[model samples]
Target chain A: MAGIIMEIVQKGWPISRIKKFIYLGFLLVAAIFTVLYIVKTNPINYVSDKLPFTLGNEKPRFLFSIYGSGMNGGLSKPMDVTFVNDRIYITDTGNKRVQIFDRSGNSVGLFGKAGNKAGEFKFPYGITGDSEGLIYVSDMRNANISVFDRAGSFVKILADNKQLNKPGGLYISENRLYVSDIAESKVKVFDLNGKKLLEIGKAGRGKEELNSPNSVSVEGNRVYISDSGNDRVQVFDTEGKYINTLGFENNSKTSMFVNPRGIGVSGGRVFVASKVTSYVFALDQNGQKIFTLGGMGQEDENLALPNGMFIDEEGRIYIVDSANQRLVVYQN
Target chain B: MKLTRLSLILTLSLALVMAISTAAFAAQAIDSGPVKGDGRSDYAATPKNTTTTYPGGIYLEYDANGVAKDIHSNYQRNTDACASCHATHTAVGASLLQWANVTDTCNACHDGTITTTYDVVYGDFANGTRTYGGLFGGTTEGPNSLSKHNVGEVNIAAAPGGNSAGKADGFGSEWGKSFECSSCHTPHGQGRNFRILHPDVNGLATINRVKGETLTSPDNLVFSSLKAPWLYGRPYNSSNFSDSTHTAVYVNGVKQLTGFSIDYKTGKVTFTSPPTGTVTAWYVPSFKVTGDVANKLTANEKVTYKEGFNEFCGACHTDYAALTRGDGKRLTGVYQEAYRHAFGFNYSSGPNKKGLVFSNNAAKSMTNEFTCMTCHVAHGADQTWWTDWKTKSGWEGIVSGENAGSSALKRLPNMATCESCHEKGKGDYTY
Candidate 1:
């Protein structure tokens, strides 16, 4: 191949013309590097492989998955995931812990364990990292909310929360923490000090009521929940008003969402992670189906029993591809 | 300190390798399937309501593509225990119970006033956590009724964080009902327990058996499994209480602080919180559930005791779940061995203990492991939560008289309850 290239160069143009072409090639490479720098998240370890599930417009592009390859950080059944201050906090639940990562998919740090202590977590469920550099995790078995500083040092738990029953999904917005009480079927809003400011929803079959809600997310004043029991993502205002229902298929009874567990809201879209169906469903702000992200499989981008999800400021989606025991990232 | 240094060296090496690999594979554009979503602005809501035999009835609750739910097949096919409480043919009420309301349907079999076949007075529905007895299977009316749960016929409101459950004006009642059997018991059933309680850890659908999924086993934290209530026929029911330590600690935003280490020979933690801070108790990350002292329970057995039953009850009565009930970050709270006191296999009478325990053991069989039945009845009874015979403090229950309530002697409702197997302690006693 090198001899042929030399012959083609001799027959095609002079040495000076060839030098000009080489210069243009160098400029192209430089421009590509500049574009990468302009975009904050370019995926540290990128594999040029095709991801199965993506929207038709090629909006969501699959990035390198962080399944702890070489020394890239391993995860075991990570549940909920959150992004704050350019860091990813995942409830690396199977390890009875939490795993933190930087935007470039580097292992930043980790904390928690399997115990009934202040810093320990017995099955950490929903995890949220706030702008204040505080990380809050909902212990499913402990039935409490444990707060930790950015370094994962033990901060206080939510104060005297007799109302937090089977606390599952968590979110931090407007300096308040929103916790989904799986048993009580309500979203509890708490102040930064962990005092519950108010609650949203009741237990019923109504549109406004929730039955065993798991993950709760907030966009503006609207709160979205993976109403796992109801088999749909129920949207509501922060004040507990029923806004609309997302993922409502033609079959109103058993539509698209089989077991919606984790949810995320950003960039005019909603992403739902369901357990039984094992699909990360992307829906528009109006509760319309945008695209389904994954299916039940062991392949790359195919998710099995996905738990939690986080969308970065640049529209990059980080999924706790839970049962697959890996953290998957995608871009649009 | 040695292990910390080793880990630091290892981490740094790993980081260096990762950085090199990252540099090689850097700047690749994401390539995959089509761009997502239906961009249509107009959408219609066409409700698909199918016709079934039972009018206005929601039979086959929350069916997942005809997937057989876990609780549905927990028992044998012939043993249709659901018929014991609900009757589809001779229905008498909305929920199809034998009686018009839950308060009456439960009282008919519980109050001991109905028929001799099922004689037991659980007291009024509106009664709180206080107990009542002298009927069928409870503490007698005299002293045993010290502190019974109140489930009387009064208007019950939603508990804190409670939705419209068991409220008089909630699901089934408009004029307001009283203390109800449905308030605590999920009669439809979720587990082996007769009255399905709240926070049934087994109620969720586990990823271990999702349809068409390759994950044949459950991972810790059950990320793949989905948690639902009995109302949805939940399937994913498992905990993260594994035998492996797998504990990771971070302080001051760093993984494994530099100033802490564990002496392997002594199994003790040595820590000096540097300016960056350090983790506490990561040396013994978890209690060893294997070993002669731990009864050599298998992984499944260990989970039921260590993480299951306590969490089930903690769903509602959150305060009684933990040993210390400490809510402070500064304090260290430890969970006790729930089985040794309740349904576990280590409840033999201790030496130097009260004679009441000995006599009760002699009269009845105290060989059974601890369970909710060991100390309290399934329904409501006359025993307070903390008034049980053992100490409340964690790691302090082995020796008696350590805390204020450790030595208090209490009895279950039926004379045959705790008194049937455990005698009252005169002074300080151990279980």
Candidate 2:
């Protein structure tokens, strides 16, 4: 075997040396590739990319969602939706009531009827819940905000100032309740009782102002409001500090929104429903679109005149498909 | 700049290569700083740092500074021994010791019998290797001698005692997950706790078991069930009356040991200056309020409570309290003494007998009976005891180092400390 191998090598074949050189070449190339890969895929780069989508930017566009709409017996023409214990409570405007449904779309209960009474509603719009599960509803047309127990019993009428003119939206946290009156283009804060504490956002077409503000959301100290007339979402603090504007168009060249309405916040993402373009866009707090669930047009996800919207804990979108005569749900 | 970068890289690479290859060329144990006597330090305790040299070459190396270096011995009592086979820096498994794989880091070097005249082999430690010699004494049948570690058997049911719910003889059950070096041995100097505090096991159970924001009925009920025993009034003594029932509650048969006031409402078990040596009882915080709520407990309190009760103890042991207490109710809140061991078995009765029987209702306290810690280490143990709980010393009491021969004394300082009272087993248990 040695003689045969020597004969082959004598024919000028450097097999062992060539194999060793190839192995060395492979190791060198693999090392270089691994270093390059590590440098390119550094986690710092991912973090930097994600930074722009938070409260770091000027125009922080939030996502929009719709909850319950009329045409279904349980809820019709939902003007507002709030979530509690994996359940969504919709202010069913057309049914003149508030409807509750499990996260799975099963109807649980309903409150109110077509009446002008205290517990009853003419057009209920904004709805919210507190830590104790007490729900507060804005009876928009009736010009009063009503509070209800978790079991839907009418607790009391809260913050019924006639100054709550055309109250478009309502939001409540553990401490305060915010009421947005579209006609006044102002958000009014009040105690649980009918006591006005502070009023925010005056009617204005300029930046850092509200133009027919329709919806309100409060997460910690930051307050987000939808400016329908200006086609933007404005940020403010409880002290009414104008933090920033979300989805504000610098130029008309880029179609931002025709009529931005209805706002909801969940899992660090914000939802905004646009009536004019009939699209719902999801944005981080900094107003960058993470993904668009639906838009205007004849597609499976397309919404016809998507109006009021809300989001649940699981990041599912509930949209008021007003033109479609259905309550549509977009699941993550 | 480019040349400087290249030089620095080259220098680091060369230094690492040298440090890995030749211990003599290792950088000065300087940053380790002149050896201190503690295990963590590199200083030599010997004068002149020189012992009599052996005929064979001493396995010693010098750092790059040329300071004569002392070889590192297995400082950790739980770590496997080097020099059993290979030279220094040549052991295969983690911690630079002789283990075959990540799982064998503890068992590979200790994979065989360490039995001599005094120390006895218990259970098996190797494949097809059953316990050969007797345990403590070769009096009865020797324990199952098989290597329970490095088991690549994918099926948990296939391993010895794998299907047996309470049997923890050797590495009998599937490790379920392969033992990565990080799994049991934190090479980065993690604590000598079980499996190097894997991210999943470190505090996940506590974090996930936090109490809900809204205390639901079922959750609060479970929390209350764990607290009820502490809230129940202990036997109180009244010297003013001198009842025999109250006399038993004395600290030393003179001073009253109960009821200046027992406030279940305050949830604190504090002992005032009213008496000395009086044992005040408190529930383990986790048992009362879930791990999350337990964090909210006040520091002024005492009397730590625990999770397992007499029934949890009765599940495996042949204690009369456990059997009689168990009326087929699984999460039973009551602890009836009369029927304690009626459900389990009595193993100490006959010769090599193995069957569930009524408890003897022995004089010892139920807590003194077989507890969970008796056989199983609740927190993770060394990979050897972890892999083979039955066979290893320091496990179930017998360990290496300061205490070797007797299970009565353990080397790991805190052997079966939690288990001496929390023993859990019945029937003449064999690996």
Candidate 2 lDDT at B306 equals 25
TM-score (C-alpha, index-matched) for candidate 1: 0.43
In candidate 1, how many Å is residue A133 off?
A: 1.8
B115-215 in candidate 2: lDDT tens per residue? Answer: 11111222332121222221211111113122222232232233222223333322222223333333322332221111122211211122223121121
Best by TM-score: 1
Off by over 4 Å in 1: A1-59, A68-74, B1-431
Poorest lDDT segment (10 consecutive residues) of candidate 2 chain B: B109-118
Q: Which 10-residue window of candidate 1 chain A scores lowest in summed lDDT? A: A41-50
Error of 1 at A56 (Å): 6.6
Write the residue-wise lDDT of candidate 1 on B1-431 in tens digits: 54345445545666698898886445333443444322111223222323421111122233232212322221121122233335566766555654333443343223321111122343221111222121221222223333333344433333211122443221122223343556544444432232234222211212112222121121211111121111221111112333122222334334443455433223233446433343322212111111011211111111122223333433333333423333233332222212222232335654322212111122135432343323443343333322332222221223222132221223322332333445443656665
Q: Model 1, A177-197: lDDT tens per residue?
A: 898887677889998887778
Q: What value does DockQ give for candidate 2? A: 0.01
DockQ of each: 0.04, 0.01
Q: Write the per-residue lDDT of candidate 2 for residues A1-332, one digit (tens) a residue.
A: 44533443344335575456559979997987788576543333334334644322122222333344334464444556777756778776666778887767667777777665778776577788876788888865566888899879998987564656657677776468888876577889887766788888886767666766777887657888887656678899888988887763332222245456677665456777765455566567566554444443334565655556666545566676654435677643
Best DockQ goes to which candidate? 1
